[model samples]
Target: MAYVIAKKKNTDEKPFDYLPKFHTLRDGTEVILDYYDNQDEEETYRILKDIVDDGQSYPQETMETIQEFKDYYLSHDAFVVRQAQTAEVLGAFYIKPNFPGRCSHLSNAGFIVKPSARRKGIARFMAQNYLYMARDLGYKASMFNLVFVNNEGSLKLWRDLGFVEIGRIPNAGNLKGVGFTDAVQFYYDFATLPQKQ
Candidate 1:
């Protein structure tokens, strides 16, 4: 794929296949969403850990899970995005079939943006982009599971993006330093929303 230079700095660079224009701030800080390559997969492990590793964050299965995801994507489709320059993975999310065979059109996804990048619209960008990608691949909908009820940022983002709160699992996750929190299930129907121009 031809990667476009979404954003640029004084340093030399190449284009990114899927990211949008990189924007520069008044202080000269540039933010770009570059594709997550194999070289960056290891860093993704630590990034995923830092964000989802609440007391309820699942175990070291991340490596295996990511590897499995990579393998699966070899025959399917997957995408991840990271903040350029710092290489500190901003957040990575992808679309995958909910099941094999007849259920392949139904998709599932998970998202995680680094703590520092919160409120910066990275999550929104990822969600928006993934929806288009999913539609292009003929997906019917996107389902997100285990969203912490206390995660106001994501809850609001998904809701604004057209994901509905279909169910809630009581006391599903331990809030690490705090007590347990309910896990809310969300679903996004691609056919229900207008396409981004």
Candidate 2:
């Protein structure tokens, strides 16, 4: 089980450097982190669009072609996790400054894993790695703005990782016939408890 998380660069070989790998409980699958090149705006957006389209996920960011241009064209970073051997992409995530001006000390992240890779700890790894990256990049806090209340797995994972619920939007999301559901907001102060670098 080998893997890595390399910074995105314009190379022909492995796009990501080796980070770490984990195994699935039943089938014994392996996964790793791979940063998305902020330079390849077009290709990266296509990959993100495909994931969102396939998962039918929330907030409809499908129209966001250039994530690098989100925060006054000074956005943070994004990455995708994939298998080393088979080259199977498991998920992707983005870390952006929480706001402009003084609020830029804080950051927010969004993650989506392929359906075939769920329940395998890929998201947990991605989330943990993102936090580590944020800290290394000098961010003071991290937040998740639109975590749907029904997303039990993510809520539990984040909670266990020390994130706390700060607020909830009343009926913020529609889950098919389930009517509207509240979107929970979670926050983590990274400055107080520094992650191991």
lDDT of each: 0.63, 0.66
Clash number by candidate, in order: 7, 5
Looking at model 1, residue 30 earns an lDDT score of 60
**True-vs-predicted CA distance for residue 139, candidate 2, Å:** 0.9
Could you tell me every candidate's TM-score relative to the true structure?
0.71, 0.72
Candidate 1 residue pairs in backbone clash: 3-15, 3-16, 3-17, 4-15, 4-16, 5-15, 6-22
Q: For model 2, give the 10-residue run with minimal summed lDDT.
A: 2-11
Model 1 stretches astray by more than 4 angstroms: 1-29, 56-76, 84-88
Which residues of candidate 2, in runs, are more than 4 Å off? 1-27, 37-57, 61-75, 194-197
Candidate 2 lDDT over 109-184, as tens digits, reads: 7787767677877878788777777776677889788887877888899898999899999988766556678888
Worst 10 contiguous positions by lDDT, candidate 1: 3-12
State candidate 2's TM-score.
Answer: 0.72
What is the Å distance of residue 137 in model 2 from its true position? 1.1
